[model samples]
Each structure stands twice: as structure tokens, then as C-alpha cells.
Target: MRIARWTVTDLIHDGFVIDDRVVEFPDGLTVADVLARGLSATGELYERVRDAAATPLADIRLLAPLVPAAVRDFVAFEEHVEGVSAGVEGKSDVAPEWYEAPTFYFTNPHTILGPDEPVSPPVTERLDFELELAAVIGAAPGVGQANLTAGDAASVIFGYTIMNDWSARDLQGREMKVRLGPAKGKDFGMSLGPWIVTADELAPYLDADGFLAVRAEVYVNDELVGEDLVSNMGWPFPELVAYASRNSCVVPGDVLGSGTVGNGGCLGELWGRNGSLTPPPLQTGDIVRMVVEGVGELVGAVGAHVAAPQLPRARTRTRARRR
Candidate 1:
């Protein structure tokens, strides 16, 4: 099922998509409510939704499928690390530790945007977009599912959605030199949705290694710039989820991103490979569109840059005598 949160006539609603129509869930119920009920009850819930009223998909405004409780984005693509490292940090080889485990960074949950929304980036000259797939967590069936094994982590994933980890490359490169943050460089904006495709619906595309073997593509101003197969990830979704639960817990609405794909997933990789900015950075009014075969398309626009106010610089420290 394709589940969505949308608004019509200024009223928000939760519904599931059927063909070109949206079947509204009964009042006061939501996708979270359905997911909390567990996967076994999906059939009955679908029947109930089908029996209710539906609206034409064109008549409503789509929203980010859910408000994430937390967002953790992982670097699961080796090619992405290689290319981005060479491009942004001038490194040719990936760090050895990257191969030992799946790695991720937390991003802002409050700035999530949905399809067709405009992303107003901070003052930046090198704006870029990361083409990724995001897994949304649902209620776990048993207690103490923490520190899960890779095989068991699959149970907590409710569905998948398209993700755009919007970035300011220039700002990012400057900060990471201190080896601390991709912080403000990222976290300004992220995009998810159109809707969520329940995990069961994507079963046909799962590869032998458990990776989603779907094609992912990215376009800027309607021109196809990058494309890759989702299965190219160095680690699969379950492992990413499992690693996330290592000594920690992930709850329903927590999101895990599949990092950026390779072979054109982002302009930074292209720049790194070619040694020149052939396809210039994103500009105001430029449109970005991403498509993942089973998950659907997510489209967003770049709005005007919001200028930052002058920041006070830190003063140099003076030597002090031991007390």
C-alpha cells in the first residue's frame, strides 16, 4: 500500500493511494495508527479504507509521510564515499574504517519537506542534492528488540520513501576540515515523500543479498544528471537498521537514510570525477526530481537563498600563568 499524509482545503488527512485516487482513513486514525497495529492487520485496514471515501490525487497537497521522531542518515554506498571524498576533501581513497561498519550522521527532523515544497537554502554558492532512499521504522512486534541482529531488524521497517538530503557543499567542505561536523552544512533542509510504499509491496524487488534492486534517478531542471541501482549499497537496509540499534533503540517514525548513491547521485561526485563543475550548482528556481522504481517520485524546487547575519569571530586566547 502507498500511504500518505496530505491536506485538502486547508484540512490535513491521512490516506492511502489506490490507482490515481486517495482512500481516506477514518477520522482520527493515521498511518502510525495502522503501523502500530502491526503488519498482520494491513489487509483488514485496507478493506476498511477502500470502503470509505476517496479523493482524486490531484485535488490534494501531499506532505512528508510522517514527522520523524529522529533522523539518521547512513553512508552505505562506497562509490559515493570515494567520489565525494575526492571531490570535496581531495582524497582519493576511502578511510579504512568505513569498510568496518555502516556509518551515519543525525540530521534535523524539524525541517523535513514534502513533494513540491520549495527549499530555501542558507547562503551558499555550492548547493547540491543527494539522491537517497529512506526507511521509516514502525512498531516492533516484541519487546527488547534493541541490539538487533541484521536478520531481525527487518521487522521494524514499515516502508520506504524517496529522500533528498539537500546540501551546501561549500559550507560543508570548510567545516569538515576541523573533522567534526557536516552540521550546518547539512540539516537546513531535507525532502521525503510523495508517500511511503509498505515493505511488503517492494518484496518483488528484493535481491538475494536483501538489498532493494530498484533503479534510482535524479534530475535537475528536468535534465537527467545521475542514476544508479539501489542494490549498489555496500550494506543493506536491514544491516543499517541493525547497526542503528546497536546498544540503542529505534522507535516508530525514526528514519534511516541510505546515504547518496553513486554514478551521478549528486553533483559533488560528478565534480570530483571530472575535476570541473560541468553541470553547475543548484540555483534559485531550479527543480530537483528523484525517482525510485517502487517508492515513486519526489519533486522539489530551490528557492531564494536566505542570507546569514554577520557572525562574531572568536578572539585569540592569551597565554596564562599557572595558578
Candidate 2:
């Protein structure tokens, strides 16, 4: 089953997408409400409205699935890390610490966009996209919650969605040199949607190692630039979530992304493979799309570029510090 947050004319709703129709949940039933009720609520709710009238899929506007309580993107794929380190940071190998535990950084959940939205590039020089998958907190129904171990991370997973961690390479590479951020460089824009595919739906694709054997691909202006298997992650989703929930609580709505996939998953990673200079950054009007087997796709357009504006004197730090 799929859960979608969408708008039909003037009516906004969180509902089930069955066949070519949308059967909205009753009033006050927000994404948070359904999440709190666990995975079973989706089926139960759908059963209640199976015969009810639903809006056609093409008539509604899909919004960012839900505003997460928090969002953390983990570097769970070694191929992605090794490639990015070599290309972006000029490191020939990933740091040893990466193998020890799941590492991640929080991103702005407030700027999340849904399918078909326009994304304004923070920097036109090196705007890029990361193909990823996000695991929302809480298992479907009939599961344990607190004190989750990597062994049980699968039990608590609510569902999964595709993610496009939009980035400004120039801003990111510059700030990361100070050993601090990918914050301003990131956090400005991201895309998440098509809809959430429940964990139960993906069980059939799970390999013996627990990794889902799903294909992930990225396209620009309808051109297929990269593709990789979702099962290729060195550290699976469970381990990443298990590490995230350690001692601390990971409640409903909290999201953890699978980070970028293998080489060429992003333009920067692709540069690492070309044996040459980086490709041209995204220009206004470019369409970036990500497709994950079973999880659907995310599409966004590059909005017209805006020039950086002069800011208050107190904020001169952005330009004042000389390297």
C-alpha cells in the first residue's frame, strides 16, 4: 500500500492511493496521526473507505509526503563515500571510522519538496542531486519500539521513500574544508515523494543479507546518467537505524536517508569517474528525476537563478574570512 499527502482542487488530504484513485482519510487524520497508529492503520483505514468515492490521481497535487520530525542522512554506502571523498575531498579512501558505525548529519526538513516542485539552485556553478532512500521511523503494526537493536531495525521501519538530497557543490566543498559543514550547502532544498511504500511491501525483495534488491536510477532531462542496486549499501538500513536509535529515541516521523548510492549516483561522484573536470552544474529549467524500484520516483525542476544579495554588516563573515 502507498500513502500520499496531496491536494485536490481546494481540499488537502493524507490518504491511500489505490488503483487510479485516492481515498482520503477523515478530517484531523494527519500523517502524524496515521504514523502514530502504526502500519496497520493504513490497511484498516483503507478498508473503511474502499467503497467511497476517490479523486483521480491526475487531478490531485502531491505534496512533500510529510514534514518529518527530524531528518538524518547516513553515509551507509562505501562506494558513494569512497567516490565522494576522492572527488570532493581528494581523499583516495574513506576514513577508517566510517566502518565502525553509521555516520550521519541532520538536514533541514522544512525545505522538503514533493514531486513536480521547482527547486531553486543555491549555486548554479555546481548544483547536483543525490539519489537516496529514506526510512521513516516506527515499524508497521505488530512490532516492538524502544531499545531497538540493529537486529530489529527492520521490525520498526514504517516505510521507505525516494530522496533527492539537492546540493551546491561549490558551497559544500568550500565549507567542508573548514571541517564543519555541508549545512548551508545542503538544507536549502531537497525532494522527497511520489509516495511512501510500506516496509511490508518490500519484503519480497529482501536478500539473504537483508538488503533489498531494488534498482535505483537518476535521470536528467530524460537522459539516464546513472543506476545502481539499492542492495549495494555496505551498511544496510537496519544498522543505520539501529545506530540512530541508540539510547536516544527515534520517534514517528523521524527520517533516515540511505545517502547516495554507488559511483555516478550524483554528478560529483560521476566526476570522480571521468578522470577529468566536473560536468556543468544544473542550469535553470533542468529536470532532475530519481527512480527507485518499488518506491516510485521524484521529479523536480531548477528554478531561475537568483543573484546573491548584499546582507547586513554583522553577517559579513560569509565574505570577510580569508582562507
Highest lDDT scorer: 1
lDDT of 1 by residue, 26-49 (tens): 757887786666565766678877
TM-score of each: 0.96, 0.91
Least lDDT summed over 10 consecutive residues: which range in candidate 1? 137-146
- What is the alpha-carbon lDDT for the whole of candidate 2? 0.82
Which portions of model 2 miss their true places by more than 4 Å? 139-147, 311-323
Question: Over the stretch 1-323, how does candidate 2's per-residue lDDT look in tens digits?
Answer: 88889987767799888878888887659777887788876678778887888889988999888789889998788888777777766665888998888789999989998899998766457888899988987544323345577777776788999999998888898889889988878978889998888888998989999998899999999988779998888777888887887777677888899989885788887776564456666788899988999988899999976667756654435665677
Best by TM-score: 1
Report how far residue 218 has shifted in candidate 1, in Å: 0.6
- For model 1 the local lDDT of residue 295 reads 85
Give the per-residue Cα lDDT of candidate 1 at 284: 97
